[model samples]
Target: MTVRIVTDSTCDLPRELVERYGIIVVPLTVIFGEEALLDGVDIDAEQFYRRLAASKVLPRTSQPSVEQFAAAYRQAFQAGADAVLSIHISSKLSGTLNAARIAAAEVAAEAGRQIELLDSKNVSLGLGAVVLAAAERAVTGADLASVLAVATATIDAVHVVCVVDTLEYLQRGGRIGRARSMLGTLLNVKPLIHVEDGEVAPFDRVRTRARALERLAEFVREHRGASRLFVACAGNDGETEAFIERVRPDLPGTEIIRGHIGPIVGVYTGPNTLGVCPVMPV
Candidate 1:
């Protein structure tokens, strides 16, 4: 059976990998005042960040509509996929997974094939790692059940931590979750956060950006045994590469993939956000 993988734009998987793996990405909407644009489709990271800095109004994000997801599922089936394994961002973080669930039910009968939906309980590269694992398994001709098993294992093993420039973006975006309490307390410091139990939680606070980056390296050192490491940021100020260099001494001969924080996640984390996603061996 041919099992295809589907994810949302929030996965932050590189475009080449998405194309190479035949992974389908459904986009969410990013709204600015009265105007709305599709994340990763109509707007990209650079443009979104530029507008974010210049515009007086904060941009808002919305989950994809049921019709959009239904169309994606139908297209996958039309392309001869025997079954589709749809992995999405945490349902707790975004309603994207719920929309996918509704879409799956709507299209399953017409496609006459199984459409399995998975809530990754993570976002960005944290979610991307799981999707990549499942896609790799599917490309090896694994059945839907086997691919699902790999995805489940990856979701359980993956860990994500990030340091944002400020907590205001997250607070205004309503994604602060457990990190809400740190709002006023983080005035002069950088906030360290992690995805815990499918929601954002406070990790630590650093006095400087230099120290926060160092702490991110410490996080990788703690998870040195991870099978895969992905480092992502919102800017091109050489921070991602510099971070890898800083951590190279601690983890010799380990492969680290560089990724960019896409528009949707960037919408909340704001610019200059740096994060590390480590997928431990399952």
Candidate 2:
């Protein structure tokens, strides 16, 4: 049976990779003031960041409606997919996976076919790695179950870490979650952070921004067996180069992809966020 892969925009997969792999992406909405723009579609990374810099208030993110998910699944079926392997960002981070699940159920019942759903427990390139892994399998003519197996394995092996320029964006956007307490105390210090169990948590604190980036590179180097790595920067600070320079020595033979944090994630991560995501083998 032919299989198709579906993921949301939060995966942060590069556009070329998404097109080459034929991965169907349903976007989340980013509400900037009165205008609600589709992530990566109506409002691109450049546009979002520009608006973000100008606006006094932070943008709000909303998950795609159930009907959006259902339509995507229907399209998969229409494309002659005998089965679908749908993956999404962590439910704890957003209600995306829950919407995928409900839509999968609705589509499954009506189509009388199985629509597999997975919770990636990751965001950004961390989630991108899993979707690409599954898509690779599906492209190779693997069945739905086999593709799903690859996805699950990739999720287990992947590790992600990021650095926030300031706590202002996360705090203002109200996505600080567990890092809330750190809000008042160390507002001056740069935060070295990671997403664990799908929510943002502080990994370390450094007196300077450079040190936080050093810690980020060290975190990537210490992962031991990562096969591929992704380095993403959100802001136009030209820090992506600096961050990649520190990370490249350790990443030697590992495949690396560079990304800019898009508008939706940037809403919470704020401007100038840098992240390194690695997917290792089991």
Candidate 3:
């Protein structure tokens, strides 16, 4: 059976990667005031971030509708595919998974075909890693069940750490209202956060960006066990590059992919967000 892969925009995989793997991306909506734009299609990351920086009100994102996923599934099956595996962002972070589930049900009812929806339980590169693995396996003639098993194992092995420049984004997103209140009272406090089991949680707090980077590296060193690494930076290329340079010597065998954090994540992380995710064996 021919297996197809689907994923949401938050995966942060490059356009080339998506096309190369024949992966279908369903975009989440980004709302600014009364206007709604598709994440990567109607609005590119550059434009999104530009608008985000100019907007007086904070930007918000909504999950793709069930119809969107249903449409994609129909197209895939009509094109001679036998099955589909949709890997999505954490359901705890967004309703995308729920939307995918509803879409899968609708497709099954209409076409009498089953679509498997898998939640990565992580975002950005963490999600990207799983999707990439599944896509590669699918191309190599792996069955849907085997591909999904690989994706699930990769999901469990992934870990993410992010450093936000300001607490305003997190506070506005309601991720750290109470913690921000307490942390903000102190000067020069930069908090490091991690996504664990689909939810964001605080990892540590440091006095400066330098110290925050140090702590981030230390955290990765302690938790990462012989895994490929990916680094994401938002509006801080120099700092991110420097951080990678400092840590490269330590992780000798790990392959690192670097990307700028897109606007969907920028909306919540604000500018100057630096993050790292490692894909280890489960």
Candidate 4:
């Protein structure tokens, strides 16, 4: 049986990987004033961040409509997928997974086939890692149950930690969960954060960006058993490479996947958001 994978744009998997794996990516909408742009479809990371810097107001993000997800599932089925395993960002963070759930039920009922949905419980490269693991399994002729098992195992073992330039974007975007405690405390201090229990939580507070980078590197170093590590930076490639270099010496054999914070995730992370997502063995 052919099992296809579906994910939202917030997964932040590179285009080549998505195409190579034949994964379907449903996009969320980002509204800038009266104009709306589809994440990674109408606008890319460079354009989104450029507009973000010059705009006075923050852009608002909306989850994909139910029909949009339904269309994607139908597309997958039409392309000869016997079953589809849909993975998405944390439901607590965005309604994307809920949208996927609604769509899955509708499509499954109509097609009379199985459509499995999973909440990755993480975002950006964290979710990307989960999707990649499942897709990799699916490509090997694994059934839906086997692919689902791999996704579940990756979710359990994956860890995501990030350092944002400021808490303003997260606060304004209403994504700041337990990380709210780090707000209203400092001006120049970089906030270190992690996704825990499908919600954002504060990890630490650092006085300088350099210290924050060191902490992020420490995060990767500590996860020595991870099979795959993804490093992401929002709207900045230089910093992503620098962080990888900082941690490369420590992790000699682990596969490091490069990820960019896409427009949908960028709306909350803002610019210069750097993080590490490690998928340890389950």
Return the TM-score for each candidate structure.
0.98, 0.96, 0.92, 0.98
Residue runs of model 1 more than 4 Å from their true location after superposition: none
- The digit string of per-residue lDDT tens for model 2 on 233-275 reads 8865477887777678877788888887887788888887889
Scored by CA lDDT, what does every candidate get? 0.91, 0.86, 0.82, 0.91
Better structure of 1 and 3 per lDDT: 1
Model 4 misplacement above 4 A: none
Please give the lDDT score at residue 159 for candidate 1.
89
Give the per-residue lDDT digits (tens) of candidate 4, residues 20-123: 99999999999999999999999998899999999999999999999999999999999999999999989999888888899999999999989999999998
**How far is 65's C-alpha from truth in model 2 (Å)?**
0.7
Q: Write the per-residue lDDT of candidate 3 for residues 1-282, one digit (tens) a residue.
A: 678999999888878888998898998888898899898888876677678778999988888998999888888888777789999988888888998999898897888776899989888878988998899888887788998899988987888888887768877876552345345454678888778888777777888988899998886687546567878887678898999898888887787788767767777878888999888865
What shift in Å separates residue 108 of candidate 4 from its native position after superposition? 1.0
Candidate 3 regions exceeding 4 Å error are 175-186, 223-225
Model 4: how far residue 20 lies from native, Å: 0.7
Candidate 2 collision pairs: none
